[model samples]
Target: MADMSALTEAEAANRLMRLAKLIAHHNARYHAEDAPEISDAEYDALVRENSALEAAFPHLVRADSPNRQVGASVETSPLAKVAHEKRMMSLDNAFDDAEVEEFVARVRRYLALPADAPVAMTAEDKIDGLSLSIRYENRVLKQAATRGDGQVGEDVTANVRHIADIPQSLRDDAPDLFEVRGEVYMAKADFVALNARLMVAGQALAESKNEAFDPETVRQFANPRNAAAGSLRQKDAAVTASRPLRFLAHGWGAHSALPADTQMGVMQAIGRWGFPLSEHLRRFENAAELLAHYRGIEALRADMPYDIDGVVYKVDRLDWQERLGFVAKAPRWAIAHKFPAERAQTDLVAIDIQVGRTGKLTPVGRLTPVTVGGVVVSNVTLHNADEIARLGVRPGDRVVVQRAGDVIPQVVENLTREEPRNAFVFPDHCPACGSEAVREEGEVDVRCTGGLICPAQRFERLRHFVSRGALDIEGLGEKTIQEFLDLGWIDEPADIFRLSQHRDELVGRKGWQEKSVDGLLESIRAKTSPDAARLLFGLGIRHVGAVTARDLLKRHTTLPALRALAEDIIALRAATEPLPDEPPHRFQARIDKAIADHIGVENVGAAVGHALADFFHEPHNVQAWEDLLNEVSPPDYKVDVRESAVSGQTIVFTGKLETMSRDEAKAQAEALGAKAAGSVSAKTDLIVAGPGAGSKLKKAAELGIRVIDEAEWAEIVRGG
Candidate 1:
């Protein structure tokens, strides 16, 4: 063995600093916000790297190195203080399919149990909420506290008291003191409804400038776990009570109420004592049966009402559990064998078009409701008409639904064997407003010709207008805005900001109690900082995507500048109507070239300019802008984004990449400063041609696009 006795203090300090930053970044993604930058495998690699470094240079590890810690360090006031009898240690997590399987094998090996050993597991929704310890004394619920620092927690007895599901007084036949710890999460339905209610009443909403930003008002939880944590620590008990927060017991930190012979029995006894234990948890006798149970859990995850991060596998015998004990933070006897986050495979029954509040017709796939990871995902998004056609999907076909990372659910494949049920015909009329749908040339999506009169477009437009991305309206949703629209509460977008005149009408609605309506109206009254991008996107201009919206905002920086650009485009078009003698194809090419050149200066293209011209040329479009400007002011933003990394860069990725999957790599490049062209082109920056790269490779050579393998791509990201 190496001596390892000559480590210096200075060297150790540097190591500790790096570990702290890495762990902090991971925690920020994993706890504060739901979106994580790294995949589970990448995260595990970092964790292992940190762990190895700590072990090698033990003196360098900080007290707060993630390898040695669990839970957040943030502290809040106004909660009751309760010390944990046993530390509420966090579990060791597994990210993907292989890690989960590995965990099962390791557990069996360590237990000295038979190859076909009898074991059991509990799979429950890993609620994206707060964690709390509710203590009971002599069967009477005494106090509840937030999971502050594992050692101490703030008292939340009053707010806990408000949760009807949590028994205030346990059954008489109980032990002296008991503690139950679990997550408190807001239901999706409840959250949606609450947002809707807020919108109906007309309220202001908060916006996050950073994707990593976690706000208090928005249940913008990092995941089910963080959501639960935030819900438990509200300063006001009434605010906690008002939230649709509920608790489900996963396990106990300390308990004297049930016999410790078996954890299953303990769970049953806990449930008998009025704790809300899930009915879906199961026990298995052998590894085969355990694996089967996991599959069953995976299958049932979507149907279940709550969100589950993964499945928990544990040894059945309490004595065995005692023998196994724990290693570091995680219990040796129990491992959470989580299923890959909520996924579902269903028949892509049909593709249906939905006219948005902006009159943009979006094609949505209707599927058999199958649970993928945990959520009952019945409808996978088809994005736009272009995607549906590209996928070659039609009605009555089986499709695989997948939710990769935090990205929305999408149809991955056409798994159906049956073919040729009539082709999906794009609708000509807006289903919501009955406005004739028009697909402009050289564009992907079809838009409603109806403009504002279409109810769907009107409603969606209003919502988008008040949306954080647009106008940042605090309290407007489909329901409330629809109600306002139906009741003549507001017609034009400006009317929302000027709703004081209809104060009497607003308060008279069925759900609009005086206090709620007043609160909502007050929230709506506080909107002054509208930005140029927000206003532009709010207008629902077709082909002017989110990126383009931001670009326009940055370039113009003010409403006046944008108005001038619009006027220039309008005048330019008026002076140059299509030449009658000009060949249609030649004229189209010339128009495309001119538009491309203009937008190219700002890194935009022909499509965006044409879209802007179309909107500005219309009189109604000008009126909408004027109406918006009257009520809101545009924010100043400096346009200084470098040409995106993928901009004009053609990259074709093939085979499996250790860092990211094909689609993921594509998405990352697109998100970063680059352009991910489908095929290799002369403009290609680098062809990330992986193993099994076929035609793309041949094409790349022909086009003189530089081809590189996966290793090269990895090197670029690592700054090698």
Candidate 2:
């Protein structure tokens, strides 16, 4: 973990913002799609880092902080959403005995009990499965839902009925309006069998089609948790019935009447009401007993029928629990003591370089199959060239592979580093296109300069182009893009617009029907007059992000004008020369200032200018750009400016906007016909300063620019 002490407030705020986005992406993948790219340990590490930073700089906490969220949204789910009567909250985690002890101590302290007072708690294995809430009305099953963003969830009542472990009707003595909350899980054996069946089915279908079976094309669950989630959340109840799944009740919500005064007693009542309870669930008088039980469960983990990543401890006393209450996203009365990532020794068979969409080369280490926690690990990310060098890893070395957070396997140490014969040489050329790859100064990644020419980069770039943040053409997903790319129907951004020409051929294909093909083509045609900023951002130019693209387009108005400016800047840079008396640094600074002035846009600096110039400098890029423009003519960029007091004024927003995001503040400014600049300068007419304004606030005062608090800015916005 990086030192929070070393980070400036601005840098911390920026990191918190990025962490918020990164965590949200992973949450959507895990919770919504049932597909996780990183391990549980990796995700936990990120959360911990975010928490640490937030703790150090509490004011820097973002509105979208992971700490404030429970699960991903279910808006995109096919199933109807059920608004949870009571929120399905998550639990705080503890990794060590010390933390566990502290949790018990904290609970006791919150309850105002003496240090020696016994705080009996219930301890049970935290099942790694999809969280489910099954509501019962008048002893009959009413509705079942998958936890989605805590407050809302996808209705899976029809699907849960297929799981035999979940009782359709509770006992006669059960609460009339009780919500039994538990995990709907797949057993390890069932998960393995299901994956095997899927593989065989995939191969059989391939054979029927008279095509070679490709193992990579077969969809298989990454883990039992994912398998359970994907199986139980199916849109079709018949599909859920076909899969073997089980449920174990841990708690309840929205109960009409109390069944017991203590946690263990209530769990017993729930078990008596025909719900499967954890066999290992036990009550402990103190933290010591709880820790002992946790260890016992950890020992039994591998032998268990299903996956469990941790043990959860909840205060047994019901009234005390009520007094303890909840925090932002978790109960203060309970904590989950997570197990450390499992590790094993494996032979590093080979290291392969894979190029990402951005042309960066990532080294992946292939390993001899070894089970770290129960899942077999064969491949691990070496991260980058620097990581490989740091670990002194090479092909044919024995390495320690850990299933960190038990999701993604990674190489932690090269055991045979001292016994290595020759150090592996990192490749300097793109493996897919044989293009020159170079590591830029101050960057750890070695990237292929081939850009769109590289096959890997080309495929990824097309996928990104149709991504939600880009042109976002409906029906153009990863599989469709790859299929089209393979069929030679598309190669560049321009080729996407030309896809309508292949309508007949597409409809004749196996999966593509006439309606679907036409719909896809229509979606492509819709982008003929694409937003200029989106089009520019979709080009995958270096150092030019969506915001920067918008800033540039706002100044230039049109794509042709932007290109013309880039060319002029390139010519000006080429014409400039350093004087003999001028230092190299001074000359470089002068050149940068000239470029910045030439662009005349705040935040779009020398780096962006140079990137644009370099992109247009390439003949192939220019040709592609012209070809794309020929296929689709984007309209001149425009912002719907409204008349307001700040009309035509350049306003800079500084520090934290308590009720709104920085982006939101900027958008508000744009709507009010104000130009939002990034920095406070002589050109800046006003500064909207919030808490922790820092250097920008000082600069605004120094420049004698009129500054107003966020409330005052809000009032101005209201007046506008």
Tens digits of per-residue lDDT, candidate 2, 476-561, equal 99999989998998999999999988888898798988888988988988889999999998888876666667878878999999
Least lDDT summed over 10 consecutive residues: which range in candidate 2? 9-18
TM-score, per-candidate, Cα-based: 0.43, 0.69
Question: Residue 294: error of model 2 in Å?
Answer: 1.6
For residue 24, give model 2's deviation from the true position in Å.
3.9
The TM-score of predicted model 1 comes to 0.43
Candidate lDDT (C-alpha), each? 0.64, 0.85
lDDT score, candidate 1, position 659: 45
